[model samples]
Target: MNEAGDTGLAEVRVDVWLWAARFFKTRSLAKQAIVGGHVDVNGGGCKPAKTLRAGDRLRIARGEERLEVEVLALSERRGPASVAQALYRETDASRLARETARAERRMVGATAPPKRPDKQARRELRRLKDGG
Candidate 1:
């Protein structure tokens, strides 16, 4: 067990810390993510019970967004997002990569044509092409 006094610092369970830090709506969700293999601590995959400490880096994915953060402090109680943001700092590279990927996905989706065909329009086009 980490005996580090609260300079707002210490090692704590990843699931608990994630909930306290407002990364998820609840501790159970964080645990689910860990078990689902979506959370990485210190550049390695970890269980929900894994201990996290100050300066340890984490890679977490929610939907299409991936977050990379360095733990700065530990907490046991849930907090506001602003306070949670203070508990960890996001890496610039991760932020940029997520943003770029999201934008590219949006562009590709927007440029793609509709897959379904309208019955009347299809018949009319066929009639014209066949000179009928």
Candidate 2:
């Protein structure tokens, strides 16, 4: 009913909107992020129950990717990915920075050891440690 052509009549909760937008797997996780100070609304900390309106700015930090997005629509219930995408618009700079950081992380991880050593590698390491 507000701007951005959103059909919803009422403002949505920040956590619910984040969940509906697929920012988090669940509303609980979104609430946790808000409480942890990883989410900022309009450049300041806000509660999970904060009402989100169209055109509001949100900054969310999830692991190595930080996102700056503008609320485009309000939805309390989660929907399909495409529909969820319509709920917010990520800033171009945020998208580019996220991609760059992801690439950097991939490059760094490419040189790291396997997450778990195989039996042969484990035996070899043990033998070397025992001076065998």
Candidate 3:
């Protein structure tokens, strides 16, 4: 058991880890996401209060993006981005997949809707159709 003298607990809560690691904006949001099945710990679904420790793998799905990271440290309090980053490490495959998805999105930007026929366009189409 990895005990933190302050909490006197072997590990930190999953939701607290998520929030502290910058995965969610708030602990409530992290709990909500966990309850909603947006997060998986060690290939299995976990609850907000699930105990988390170093070396655990997590799968977090946020919108269309999914991140798989290995927990490197545990913390209950939120910190700056640099400190938060030290809490976990994203796997290489996950990083490559995310970049590929981003590139695909950029290449397939929103398509323009088909042009509608206005008064002039309608008349022209009608004339063409009528062989005039």
Candidate 4:
């Protein structure tokens, strides 16, 4: 059989893999990310149709977080979270970088208001906006 060893599968599209791997909520979103150049394979940008096989490396930029992963398996159909996670193996460096970035973001976010203002605060803000 092929590398993934599931029903003799051979190829899986990049976008389909991303979605099936739980990187994107839907296939359309994965396609959008691919078309927007946020997904790369083997150190270069690739089309959504690019086939991914076992051992292929991927660099994905999702919002402010970046991920580097190696394809451990291939699946064209989306599955449960636990199964989806099995499709790829994230590099240690990528996980560490993501954690560090999240920590920094949390630190910076501490300066912002945690929740919406109460009714009185809204009235005061409205008054200020009206210049009165």
How does each model score on lDDT? 0.84, 0.88, 0.88, 0.88
Candidate 2, 40-61: lDDT as tens digits:
9999999999998889999999
What are the TM-scores, per candidate, against the unseen true structure?
A: 0.77, 0.82, 0.78, 0.81
RMSD after Cα superposition, model 1: 4.2
lDDT of 3 by residue, 1-132 (tens): 332223343589999989988999999999999999999999999989999988899999999899999988888878788888888899999999999999888766766466788999999999999999
The TM-score obtained by model 1 is 0.77
Native-to-model Cα distance after best TM-score fit, residue 42 in candidate 3, in Å: 0.3
Counted clashes in each candidate structure = 0, 0, 0, 0
Evaluate residue 13 in candidate 1 and report its C-alpha lDDT on the 0 to 100 scale: 91
Clashing pairs in 2: none
Badly placed stretches (over 4 Å) of model 3 are 1-9, 110-132
Instruction: Write model 1 residue lDDT over 22-55, tens digit each, in one string.
Output: 8899899999999998999887899988888888
lDDT by residue for model 4 over 97-128, one digit each (tens)?
A: 99999999998998977689999999999999
